[model samples]
Target chain A: MIEFSNWDILRNLLLAAQWTLLLSIAAFIGGTVVALTLTAMRLTRNVVVMRIVRVYVELFQGTPLLMQMFLCFFGLSMIGYEISAWGAAILSLTLFTSAFLVEIWRGCIDTLPKGQWEASRVLGLNFLQTLRHVILPQATKVAFAPTVGFSVQVVKGTALASVIGFVELTKAGTMLNNATFEPFKVFAFVALIYFALCYPLSLCSKYLEKKYHVAR
Target chain B: MSLVKLDQVHKYYGDFHVLKGIDLNIKVGEVVSIIGKSGSGKSTLLRCINGLEAYQQGGIAVDDKEVTSEDIQVRRLALSVGMIFQSFNLFPHLTVGENIMLAPTIVLKKSKQEAEKTARAMLEKVGLGDKFDRYPEKLSGGQQQRVAIARALAMNPKVLLCDEITSALDPELVGDVLKVLEQLAAEGMTLILVTHEMNFARDVGDRVVFMHQGKVWEEGNSKKLLSEPQTEELKQFIGAVL
Candidate 1:
């Protein structure tokens, strides 16, 4: 067995963490755009559009995300099309994150009192116009804390990308453990790295919840 | 032409009929008060005039445009009819001035400067000139309701619907709101109100209508309705109020 050096392990984990951060950011921004689109589609009155969004939500929510990543990465390659592991991981995470975000956002919209809708409608705003002016501004306050809290989940979710040949902190830790034959130490270091990234965001989310009472 | 006319208007909430074969006409600048017990479809009638609630079978015309279209003529009718709810329903996210200016700027397509000027003038009229920057939650219930009234009035609607506007206020706060509404009525704003304030109904309403069991039971000048109600239900309602 190779001798494990703590400094080398720390250095590798830190370098790999940059990719984890980048991946999470990529997934979050892409997911927000898609989630907003899904929210609009879900809010529409057309039965066919609503049914399509419902199926999209159910399919993404019901399937295991790890299987989704595997299918997106290797399954696509099997059809004579080669895509990088990074592309596949980002695509899968984007789709998964958006599905969950859309559901969370739709709940925020639904939480709005019926009176606001009636008030805006009486003001002669169409559905989209109402959303842009009245409903969304109020809903944003409700959506804020929970959305920040959900980012913590996304940061943790980056670990699953390691299974698809992506070189994130978790993947790096696995490689380091195999070479050094020290699972406990490597895993503990990996956990610390994640804590360092996630703890501040969790604190910020709690602070927002207190200040805004977003859940209420 | 009368500002509003409803003919054989029928509204239902899953077979529990709310408005049954109702016929009414209100000329411009008329202040009509509808008094009824709770769940007597008084609020429903006010809502139907603005198309806020869909009636199963009816024809409501606001300023002579048919309101029973599939596309729904909300914008045109809304420009002519403004509604104030029991709960103020001010957009909490917006400031008082912003709340008042929103419809003018958006629905009426007025410029920001014009809308803001109109909003400030209206707020001054409502005795809230200094409260323009405040959020709705920062205002008292009466103050917020005044802002709501100001918001609707900025649209320059020909008809104003007040649905139990003072029901949520404290007794002390009710006077201030009624004063503002009284001022609006005195200025010749065509007003339709569903109210529990019997004295205000008798004093301020030009016409008093008693809706009972989903139809207008008795209606005439407020003096006649208050002193000599024709139906047993109206007498019982007035007896309870007095």
Candidate 2:
């Protein structure tokens, strides 16, 4: 049996934490692109497209992230679409993050007065022009806090990737636990690291919400 | 020739009839004020001219262009028919100059220099020449409403629709907005206004239309129609608002 020192476990977990941070960043960026495309289709007011997007959102949001990760990692391989655990983890988290962000952004967009749309229409500005000039500038301000807040959830969600054999922060903790037989200390450090990453985001979200609310 | 026309236009939101056979017209450079009770579809009729709301039956035309709620047709109509709302609907993100310049620059495809030239002219026309750089939220209600007028005029529309433009303002602020409308009316700018301000209707409007329960209940010379309303609904509306 190889006995592990406290420094040894901490060092390994910190190295693995890099992968978690990278995964989170990739997922956030990917999620934003997908969510924006989905949001645009949702706004097109085409009934068929809207229904498909709605189902897509419902499918991801209604199911557990764990199941999604498992399906992406294992289900695809069974069907001969061989994907790495890293690929599957990123794909699932991006899908999950976007599903929530689209709905969050929709709420932000809907908060504007209907007169904004009506006024723009009356002025001869087309839909895209109105969105670019009048709607987005305002909606973006309202969306900022909620978007930052949702990033914290994305960061935490990376922990679930461990169940699919993608070695992130939580997987590193588990590996350290097995090597050192010190689950309590190892898991505590893992949780503390997560808090370190997420607490500032929570504070930022609260700060922004207050700032936008006051401006409104 | 009638610059704006709505022929027996009927509109419904599901089963609730909003504008039932509204027949009206405004010749070139005429000012028409529409007054009515709430839910009487006065604003809806004004909205029909700009194709803001589609009518299931009948037709609306502005400057000889067919008006429909279809996107392309409405975009074409918008160049010649401008509508301002009671809320002043000024883009809060933009300065007054930018607000007035938006439609001209984007829809008309004018150069920024040309749009600004027109915007400054419109602002000067509305007595907001000095407020060209102010934000909508930073201005008084009357000042913001003036900016909205400048925005609509920046489109160079043949007909202007004002939907209860002064109803949202403080009593002290109402006069300034009305004064701008009066100046526009005097300049032979064709205007269709849905208003609660009876004095402006009688004083500036060439014709007055009184709508009741989704119909044009009474319409005549502005002073005659308002002073001697033939219908009980018109009498009641006047009583309530005055």
State which candidate has the highest TM-score: 2
**Residue B176 shift from truth in candidate 2, angstroms:** 0.5
Off by over 4 Å in 1: A214-216, B69-72
In the range A36-93, model 2's lDDT, one tens digit per residue, is: 9999999999999999899999999999999999999999999999999999999999
Per-residue alpha-carbon lDDT of model 1 for B1-242, expressed as tens digits? 68899999999899698899889999888889999888889898888888887788868898888885343477667788898998898998899999999989988899999999999999998889999999888889999999999999899888999999999999999999999989998999999999988888889889998999899888999988899988899999999989
Residues B59-129 of candidate 2: C-alpha lDDT, one tens digit per residue: 88888888889988888888888888999898888999999998888889999999999999999998989
TM-score of every candidate's chain A: 0.95, 0.97
lDDT of 1 by residue, A1-216 (tens): 557689999999999999999999999998899999989998887899888888888888899889889889999999977989899888888988898999999999999889898887777777777889999988988888889899988899889999988999999999999898889999999999999999988998889879778434
Q: Model 2, stretches more than 4 Å misplaced?
A: none
Q: Chain A alone, model 2, TM-score? A: 0.97
Question: Mind sharing the TM-score for model 2?
Answer: 0.97
Q: Tell me the lDDT of candidate 1.
A: 0.89
